[model samples]
Target: IALECILLLILQQIAAPGPQESADDSPGIALAWKAHQIIRSRFHLPLSTAVLAKELHCNADYLGRVYRRTFRLTLTEAIHRQRVLAAEKLLISNSLSLTEVARQCGFSDTSYFRQIFRKHTGLTPAGWKQRYCKEHINS
Candidate 1:
Protein backbone atom coordinates (compact mmCIF):
# COMPACT_ATOMS: atom_id res chain seq x y z
CA ILE A 1 0.00 0.00 0.00
CA ALA A 2 2.88 2.39 0.83
CA LEU A 3 4.56 1.65 -2.52
CA GLU A 4 1.33 2.29 -4.42
CA CYS A 5 0.80 5.63 -2.67
CA ILE A 6 4.36 6.74 -3.53
CA LEU A 7 3.87 5.78 -7.17
CA LEU A 8 0.60 7.68 -7.36
CA LEU A 9 2.24 10.81 -5.89
CA ILE A 10 5.04 10.62 -8.43
CA LEU A 11 2.55 10.27 -11.30
CA GLN A 12 0.56 13.22 -10.05
CA GLN A 13 3.68 15.34 -9.87
CA ILE A 14 4.65 14.38 -13.37
CA ALA A 15 1.20 15.16 -14.74
CA ALA A 16 0.94 18.54 -13.04
CA PRO A 17 1.58 21.70 -15.03
CA GLY A 18 4.95 23.16 -14.21
CA PRO A 19 6.32 26.61 -14.88
CA GLN A 20 7.63 25.57 -18.28
CA GLU A 21 4.23 24.27 -19.36
CA SER A 22 2.39 27.48 -18.45
CA ALA A 23 4.21 29.80 -20.85
CA ASP A 24 1.59 32.53 -20.72
CA ASP A 25 2.19 32.90 -17.00
CA SER A 26 5.94 32.96 -17.29
CA PRO A 27 8.21 35.82 -16.24
CA GLY A 28 9.59 36.20 -19.75
CA ILE A 29 6.18 37.12 -21.09
CA ALA A 30 5.72 39.64 -18.33
CA LEU A 31 9.11 41.13 -18.96
CA ALA A 32 8.42 41.39 -22.66
CA TRP A 33 5.14 43.15 -22.03
CA LYS A 34 6.74 45.57 -19.64
CA ALA A 35 9.43 46.30 -22.15
CA HIS A 36 6.82 46.97 -24.80
CA GLN A 37 5.00 49.37 -22.53
CA ILE A 38 8.19 51.19 -21.67
CA ILE A 39 9.09 51.50 -25.32
CA ARG A 40 5.69 52.89 -26.20
CA SER A 41 5.72 55.44 -23.40
CA ARG A 42 9.35 56.48 -23.64
CA PHE A 43 10.25 56.12 -27.26
CA HIS A 44 10.90 59.84 -27.52
CA LEU A 45 13.70 59.44 -25.03
CA PRO A 46 17.01 57.71 -25.54
CA LEU A 47 16.65 53.96 -25.07
CA SER A 48 18.44 50.74 -25.84
CA THR A 49 18.59 47.07 -24.84
CA ALA A 50 20.89 47.83 -21.94
CA VAL A 51 18.78 50.80 -20.87
CA LEU A 52 15.61 48.72 -20.97
CA ALA A 53 17.21 45.81 -19.13
CA LYS A 54 18.44 48.12 -16.41
CA GLU A 55 14.99 49.63 -16.11
CA LEU A 56 13.41 46.17 -15.91
CA HIS A 57 16.10 44.77 -13.56
CA CYS A 58 17.04 41.92 -15.88
CA ASN A 59 20.05 40.88 -17.85
CA ALA A 60 20.42 42.76 -21.12
CA ASP A 61 21.00 39.64 -23.18
CA TYR A 62 18.09 37.86 -21.57
CA LEU A 63 15.84 40.89 -22.14
CA GLY A 64 16.88 41.04 -25.76
CA ARG A 65 16.20 37.35 -26.24
CA VAL A 66 12.82 37.50 -24.55
CA TYR A 67 11.77 40.68 -26.38
CA ARG A 68 12.77 39.27 -29.74
CA ARG A 69 11.01 35.99 -29.03
CA THR A 70 7.83 37.72 -27.95
CA PHE A 71 7.75 40.56 -30.51
CA ARG A 72 9.67 39.01 -33.44
CA LEU A 73 11.94 42.07 -33.56
CA THR A 74 15.02 43.35 -31.77
CA LEU A 75 14.90 46.19 -29.27
CA THR A 76 16.62 48.53 -31.70
CA GLU A 77 14.10 47.75 -34.39
CA ALA A 78 11.21 48.36 -32.04
CA ILE A 79 12.65 51.70 -30.92
CA HIS A 80 13.22 52.80 -34.49
CA ARG A 81 9.70 51.83 -35.45
CA GLN A 82 8.28 53.87 -32.61
CA ARG A 83 10.48 56.84 -33.48
CA VAL A 84 9.48 56.61 -37.13
CA LEU A 85 5.81 56.61 -36.21
CA ALA A 86 6.33 59.72 -34.12
CA ALA A 87 8.25 61.36 -36.92
CA GLU A 88 5.43 60.59 -39.34
CA LYS A 89 2.95 62.36 -37.10
CA LEU A 90 5.20 65.37 -36.68
CA LEU A 91 5.89 65.49 -40.41
CA ILE A 92 2.22 65.63 -41.24
CA SER A 93 0.87 67.76 -38.40
CA ASN A 94 3.32 70.65 -38.47
CA SER A 95 6.02 72.47 -40.35
CA LEU A 96 8.91 71.16 -38.26
CA SER A 97 12.16 70.81 -40.15
CA LEU A 98 13.61 67.35 -40.62
CA THR A 99 16.36 68.11 -38.12
CA GLU A 100 13.87 69.30 -35.52
CA VAL A 101 11.68 66.30 -36.17
CA ALA A 102 14.67 64.04 -35.69
CA ARG A 103 15.61 65.73 -32.44
CA GLN A 104 12.10 65.59 -31.03
CA CYS A 105 11.73 61.96 -32.03
CA GLY A 106 14.87 60.95 -30.07
CA PHE A 107 17.16 60.63 -33.01
CA SER A 108 20.52 62.27 -32.30
CA ASP A 109 21.58 62.28 -35.92
CA THR A 110 19.44 63.69 -38.70
CA SER A 111 21.16 61.51 -41.32
CA TYR A 112 20.56 58.34 -39.38
CA PHE A 113 17.01 59.43 -38.80
CA ARG A 114 16.52 59.87 -42.50
CA GLN A 115 17.97 56.45 -43.21
CA ILE A 116 15.81 54.68 -40.66
CA PHE A 117 12.72 56.71 -41.54
CA ARG A 118 13.20 55.81 -45.15
CA LYS A 119 13.77 52.18 -44.30
CA HIS A 120 10.52 51.89 -42.34
CA THR A 121 8.47 54.38 -44.39
CA GLY A 122 9.92 53.87 -47.93
CA LEU A 123 10.15 57.65 -48.33
CA THR A 124 12.46 60.37 -47.10
CA PRO A 125 11.12 62.63 -44.38
CA ALA A 126 11.00 65.60 -46.75
CA GLY A 127 9.38 63.53 -49.43
CA TRP A 128 6.80 62.15 -47.05
CA LYS A 129 5.97 65.62 -45.75
CA GLN A 130 5.67 67.01 -49.26
CA ARG A 131 3.40 64.20 -50.35
CA TYR A 132 1.26 64.41 -47.24
CA CYS A 133 0.89 68.17 -47.52
CA LYS A 134 0.02 68.01 -51.19
CA GLU A 135 -2.55 65.27 -50.70
CA HIS A 136 -4.20 66.92 -47.70
CA ILE A 137 -4.20 70.39 -49.28
CA ASN A 138 -5.81 69.08 -52.45
CA SER A 139 -8.52 67.41 -50.37
Candidate 2:
Protein backbone atom coordinates (compact mmCIF):
# COMPACT_ATOMS: atom_id res chain seq x y z
CA ILE A 1 0.00 0.00 0.00
CA ALA A 2 2.82 2.39 0.85
CA LEU A 3 4.51 1.54 -2.41
CA GLU A 4 1.27 2.13 -4.29
CA CYS A 5 0.89 5.57 -2.77
CA ILE A 6 4.44 6.48 -3.55
CA LEU A 7 4.06 5.29 -7.10
CA LEU A 8 0.84 7.22 -7.51
CA LEU A 9 2.44 10.33 -6.14
CA ILE A 10 5.27 9.96 -8.62
CA LEU A 11 2.85 9.48 -11.48
CA GLN A 12 0.93 12.55 -10.45
CA GLN A 13 4.10 14.58 -10.33
CA ILE A 14 5.11 13.40 -13.77
CA ALA A 15 1.67 14.06 -15.16
CA ALA A 16 1.61 17.60 -13.78
CA PRO A 17 3.79 20.47 -14.82
CA GLY A 18 6.84 20.68 -12.59
CA PRO A 19 7.79 23.42 -10.23
CA GLN A 20 9.92 26.24 -11.49
CA GLU A 21 13.53 26.35 -10.36
CA SER A 22 14.63 29.05 -8.00
CA ALA A 23 17.89 30.82 -8.80
CA ASP A 24 19.23 29.90 -5.39
CA ASP A 25 18.74 26.25 -6.16
CA SER A 26 20.27 26.13 -9.61
CA PRO A 27 23.34 24.18 -8.48
CA GLY A 28 21.39 21.67 -6.51
CA ILE A 29 18.88 21.36 -9.32
CA ALA A 30 21.70 20.69 -11.72
CA LEU A 31 23.03 18.06 -9.40
CA ALA A 32 19.64 16.44 -9.23
CA TRP A 33 19.32 16.50 -13.01
CA LYS A 34 22.77 14.99 -13.41
CA ALA A 35 21.92 12.38 -10.83
CA HIS A 36 18.84 11.44 -12.80
CA GLN A 37 20.89 11.17 -15.97
CA ILE A 38 23.32 8.91 -14.20
CA ILE A 39 20.45 6.87 -12.90
CA ARG A 40 19.08 6.39 -16.39
CA SER A 41 22.38 4.99 -17.59
CA ARG A 42 23.25 2.98 -14.52
CA PHE A 43 19.87 2.14 -13.02
CA HIS A 44 20.25 -1.53 -13.89
CA LEU A 45 23.15 -1.69 -11.46
CA PRO A 46 22.92 -1.82 -7.71
CA LEU A 47 22.41 1.81 -6.67
CA SER A 48 21.58 3.51 -3.42
CA THR A 49 21.20 6.98 -2.00
CA ALA A 50 24.61 6.77 -0.41
CA VAL A 51 26.20 5.70 -3.67
CA LEU A 52 24.49 8.49 -5.55
CA ALA A 53 25.45 11.00 -2.92
CA LYS A 54 29.03 9.87 -3.07
CA GLU A 55 29.00 10.14 -6.80
CA LEU A 56 27.52 13.61 -6.66
CA HIS A 57 29.82 14.66 -3.77
CA CYS A 58 26.92 15.68 -1.60
CA ASN A 59 25.50 14.40 1.64
CA ALA A 60 22.84 11.77 1.18
CA ASP A 61 20.23 13.67 3.17
CA TYR A 62 20.97 16.88 1.31
CA LEU A 63 20.81 15.15 -2.02
CA GLY A 64 17.49 13.56 -1.19
CA ARG A 65 16.03 16.81 0.08
CA VAL A 66 17.12 18.86 -2.90
CA TYR A 67 16.10 16.20 -5.37
CA ARG A 68 12.67 15.93 -3.79
CA ARG A 69 12.31 19.68 -3.77
CA THR A 70 13.31 19.96 -7.39
CA PHE A 71 11.50 16.97 -8.82
CA ARG A 72 8.77 16.26 -6.28
CA LEU A 73 9.99 12.69 -6.05
CA THR A 74 12.71 10.80 -4.28
CA LEU A 75 15.71 9.29 -5.95
CA THR A 76 14.37 5.83 -5.32
CA GLU A 77 11.06 6.75 -6.84
CA ALA A 78 12.83 8.07 -9.91
CA ILE A 79 14.88 4.92 -10.19
CA HIS A 80 11.88 2.63 -9.91
CA ARG A 81 10.01 4.71 -12.45
CA GLN A 82 12.89 4.45 -14.89
CA ARG A 83 13.13 0.71 -14.37
CA VAL A 84 9.42 0.21 -14.97
CA LEU A 85 9.54 2.36 -18.10
CA ALA A 86 12.50 0.40 -19.39
CA ALA A 87 10.71 -2.85 -18.65
CA GLU A 88 7.72 -1.63 -20.61
CA LYS A 89 9.88 -1.06 -23.69
CA LEU A 90 11.48 -4.47 -23.36
CA LEU A 91 8.17 -6.24 -22.84
CA ILE A 92 6.84 -4.75 -26.03
CA SER A 93 8.90 -6.79 -28.47
CA ASN A 94 11.22 -8.94 -26.42
CA SER A 95 10.72 -12.54 -25.41
CA LEU A 96 12.53 -12.30 -22.10
CA SER A 97 10.94 -14.00 -19.13
CA LEU A 98 9.86 -12.09 -16.06
CA THR A 99 13.04 -12.99 -14.24
CA GLU A 100 15.14 -11.84 -17.12
CA VAL A 101 13.24 -8.60 -17.44
CA ALA A 102 13.65 -7.95 -13.74
CA ARG A 103 17.34 -8.64 -13.92
CA GLN A 104 17.76 -6.52 -16.99
CA CYS A 105 15.97 -3.69 -15.25
CA GLY A 106 18.19 -3.94 -12.14
CA PHE A 107 15.57 -5.58 -9.96
CA SER A 108 17.31 -8.37 -8.13
CA ASP A 109 14.03 -10.03 -7.19
CA THR A 110 11.29 -11.07 -9.59
CA SER A 111 8.54 -10.59 -6.99
CA TYR A 112 9.74 -7.10 -6.23
CA PHE A 113 9.73 -6.31 -9.94
CA ARG A 114 6.17 -7.56 -10.26
CA GLN A 115 5.12 -5.49 -7.28
CA ILE A 116 6.69 -2.32 -8.62
CA PHE A 117 5.39 -2.98 -12.12
CA ARG A 118 1.88 -3.34 -10.77
CA LYS A 119 2.25 -0.23 -8.69
CA HIS A 120 3.55 1.75 -11.65
CA THR A 121 1.23 0.40 -14.40
CA GLY A 122 -1.57 -1.30 -12.45
CA LEU A 123 -0.72 -4.58 -14.13
CA THR A 124 1.59 -7.43 -13.36
CA PRO A 125 4.43 -8.05 -15.79
CA ALA A 126 2.79 -11.15 -17.18
CA GLY A 127 -0.53 -9.38 -17.59
CA TRP A 128 1.19 -6.44 -19.26
CA LYS A 129 3.03 -8.70 -21.64
CA GLN A 130 -0.12 -10.60 -22.43
CA ARG A 131 -2.03 -7.46 -23.25
CA TYR A 132 0.74 -6.08 -25.39
CA CYS A 133 1.23 -9.37 -27.18
CA LYS A 134 -2.42 -9.58 -28.07
CA GLU A 135 -2.49 -6.01 -29.32
CA HIS A 136 0.72 -6.24 -31.30
CA ILE A 137 1.36 -9.64 -32.80
CA ASN A 138 4.46 -8.37 -34.54
CA SER A 139 6.37 -9.18 -31.40
Candidate 3:
Protein backbone atom coordinates (compact mmCIF):
# COMPACT_ATOMS: atom_id res chain seq x y z
CA ILE A 1 0.00 0.00 0.00
CA ALA A 2 2.79 2.43 0.80
CA LEU A 3 4.51 1.51 -2.43
CA GLU A 4 1.33 2.14 -4.38
CA CYS A 5 0.95 5.49 -2.70
CA ILE A 6 4.48 6.46 -3.62
CA LEU A 7 3.90 5.44 -7.22
CA LEU A 8 0.71 7.44 -7.35
CA LEU A 9 2.39 10.45 -5.85
CA ILE A 10 5.24 10.17 -8.32
CA LEU A 11 2.76 9.98 -11.16
CA GLN A 12 0.88 12.98 -9.90
CA GLN A 13 4.09 14.98 -9.56
CA ILE A 14 5.29 13.99 -12.99
CA ALA A 15 2.62 16.06 -14.71
CA ALA A 16 1.39 19.26 -13.14
CA PRO A 17 -2.36 19.81 -13.21
CA GLY A 18 -2.47 23.58 -13.71
CA PRO A 19 -0.52 26.32 -15.38
CA GLN A 20 0.91 27.44 -12.04
CA GLU A 21 1.42 24.00 -10.68
CA SER A 22 4.81 23.19 -9.24
CA ALA A 23 6.02 19.71 -9.98
CA ASP A 24 8.39 18.14 -7.51
CA ASP A 25 11.23 17.11 -9.75
CA SER A 26 12.90 14.80 -7.32
CA PRO A 27 14.31 11.57 -8.71
CA GLY A 28 14.22 9.85 -5.35
CA ILE A 29 10.76 8.37 -5.84
CA ALA A 30 11.52 7.11 -9.31
CA LEU A 31 14.83 5.65 -8.23
CA ALA A 32 13.18 3.97 -5.28
CA TRP A 33 10.51 2.54 -7.53
CA LYS A 34 13.13 1.26 -9.92
CA ALA A 35 14.90 -0.51 -7.11
CA HIS A 36 11.64 -2.04 -5.93
CA GLN A 37 10.75 -3.18 -9.41
CA ILE A 38 14.13 -4.78 -9.84
CA ILE A 39 13.72 -6.72 -6.62
CA ARG A 40 10.25 -7.87 -7.56
CA SER A 41 11.16 -8.85 -11.08
CA ARG A 42 14.54 -10.42 -10.45
CA PHE A 43 14.05 -12.09 -7.12
CA HIS A 44 15.12 -15.39 -8.63
CA LEU A 45 18.64 -14.17 -9.26
CA PRO A 46 21.57 -13.82 -6.92
CA LEU A 47 21.44 -10.13 -6.18
CA SER A 48 23.24 -7.90 -3.72
CA THR A 49 23.31 -4.25 -2.73
CA ALA A 50 26.54 -3.73 -4.61
CA VAL A 51 25.07 -5.37 -7.70
CA LEU A 52 21.97 -3.23 -7.55
CA ALA A 53 24.03 -0.09 -7.00
CA LYS A 54 26.22 -0.93 -9.96
CA GLU A 55 23.18 -1.46 -12.16
CA LEU A 56 21.72 1.86 -11.01
CA HIS A 57 25.01 3.73 -11.31
CA CYS A 58 24.98 4.85 -7.67
CA ASN A 59 27.08 4.08 -4.64
CA ALA A 60 26.03 0.97 -2.74
CA ASP A 61 25.62 2.77 0.58
CA TYR A 62 23.67 5.59 -0.99
CA LEU A 63 21.30 3.21 -2.73
CA GLY A 64 20.72 1.21 0.42
CA ARG A 65 20.16 4.36 2.48
CA VAL A 66 17.77 5.87 -0.05
CA TYR A 67 15.83 2.61 -0.41
CA ARG A 68 15.62 2.20 3.37
CA ARG A 69 14.55 5.82 3.88
CA THR A 70 11.94 5.68 1.14
CA PHE A 71 10.50 2.24 1.90
CA ARG A 72 11.19 1.88 5.63
CA LEU A 73 13.05 -1.39 4.90
CA THR A 74 16.38 -2.26 3.43
CA LEU A 75 16.46 -3.55 -0.15
CA THR A 76 17.94 -6.84 1.05
CA GLU A 77 15.01 -7.38 3.38
CA ALA A 78 12.57 -6.64 0.59
CA ILE A 79 14.25 -9.14 -1.67
CA HIS A 80 14.14 -11.90 0.92
CA ARG A 81 10.53 -11.08 1.66
CA GLN A 82 9.60 -11.27 -1.97
CA ARG A 83 11.50 -14.50 -2.48
CA VAL A 84 9.72 -16.11 0.44
CA LEU A 85 6.36 -15.01 -0.90
CA ALA A 86 7.17 -16.52 -4.25
CA ALA A 87 8.32 -19.72 -2.62
CA GLU A 88 5.02 -20.00 -0.77
CA LYS A 89 3.04 -20.01 -3.98
CA LEU A 90 5.34 -22.50 -5.60
CA LEU A 91 5.18 -24.74 -2.60
CA ILE A 92 1.41 -24.71 -2.44
CA SER A 93 0.59 -25.05 -6.11
CA ASN A 94 3.55 -26.83 -7.63
CA SER A 95 5.01 -30.26 -7.00
CA LEU A 96 8.58 -29.05 -7.05
CA SER A 97 11.08 -30.29 -4.50
CA LEU A 98 12.42 -28.11 -1.72
CA THR A 99 15.78 -27.67 -3.39
CA GLU A 100 14.13 -26.70 -6.64
CA VAL A 101 11.91 -24.19 -4.94
CA ALA A 102 14.87 -22.68 -3.18
CA ARG A 103 16.89 -22.47 -6.35
CA GLN A 104 14.04 -20.93 -8.24
CA CYS A 105 13.41 -18.39 -5.50
CA GLY A 106 17.05 -17.13 -5.44
CA PHE A 107 18.25 -19.18 -2.54
CA SER A 108 21.53 -20.94 -3.15
CA ASP A 109 21.06 -23.50 -0.39
CA THR A 110 18.06 -25.48 0.70
CA SER A 111 18.94 -25.13 4.38
CA TYR A 112 19.14 -21.41 3.96
CA PHE A 113 15.81 -21.44 2.16
CA ARG A 114 14.19 -23.36 4.98
CA GLN A 115 15.76 -21.00 7.50
CA ILE A 116 14.48 -17.92 5.74
CA PHE A 117 11.07 -19.42 5.10
CA ARG A 118 10.76 -20.42 8.70
CA LYS A 119 11.88 -16.98 9.77
CA HIS A 120 9.15 -15.33 7.72
CA THR A 121 6.26 -17.79 8.13
CA GLY A 122 7.21 -19.57 11.34
CA LEU A 123 6.71 -22.90 9.53
CA THR A 124 8.88 -25.15 7.51
CA PRO A 125 8.16 -25.34 3.81
CA ALA A 126 7.05 -28.96 4.01
CA GLY A 127 4.91 -28.31 7.03
CA TRP A 128 3.30 -25.28 5.40
CA LYS A 129 2.71 -27.18 2.22
CA GLN A 130 1.10 -30.02 4.09
CA ARG A 131 -1.26 -27.71 5.93
CA TYR A 132 -2.14 -25.80 2.78
CA CYS A 133 -2.82 -28.99 0.88
CA LYS A 134 -4.96 -30.42 3.66
CA GLU A 135 -6.97 -27.22 3.93
CA HIS A 136 -7.65 -27.14 0.23
CA ILE A 137 -8.60 -30.77 0.26
CA ASN A 138 -11.10 -30.21 3.06
CA SER A 139 -12.42 -27.05 1.45
For residues 1-139, could you state the per-residue lDDT of candidate 1 as single tens digits? 5985795467445534477667453588668779987998899899999999999999999999877766678999999998998999998888888899999999999999999999998999999888888889878
Candidate 1 is scored at a TM of 0.81
- Residue 25, model 3: lDDT of 25
| Candidate ranking (lDDT, best to worst) | 1, 2, 3
Question: In candidate 2, where is summed lDDT lowest over 10 consecutive residues?
Answer: 12-21
lDDT of 3 at 85: 92
Best by lDDT: 1
Which sections of candidate 3 miss by over 4 Å? 1-25
**Candidate 1 C-alpha error for residue 54, in Å:** 0.7
Pick the TM-score winner.
1
Model 3 lDDT tens row, 43-117: 999988988889998888988876775677788888999999999999987899999999999999999899999
C-alpha TM-scores of all predictions? 0.81, 0.80, 0.80
Q: Candidate 2 regions off by >4 Å? A: 1-22
Q: What is the lDDT of candidate 2?
A: 0.84
**Model 2 TM-score (2 dp):** 0.80
Model 1 steric clash pairs: none
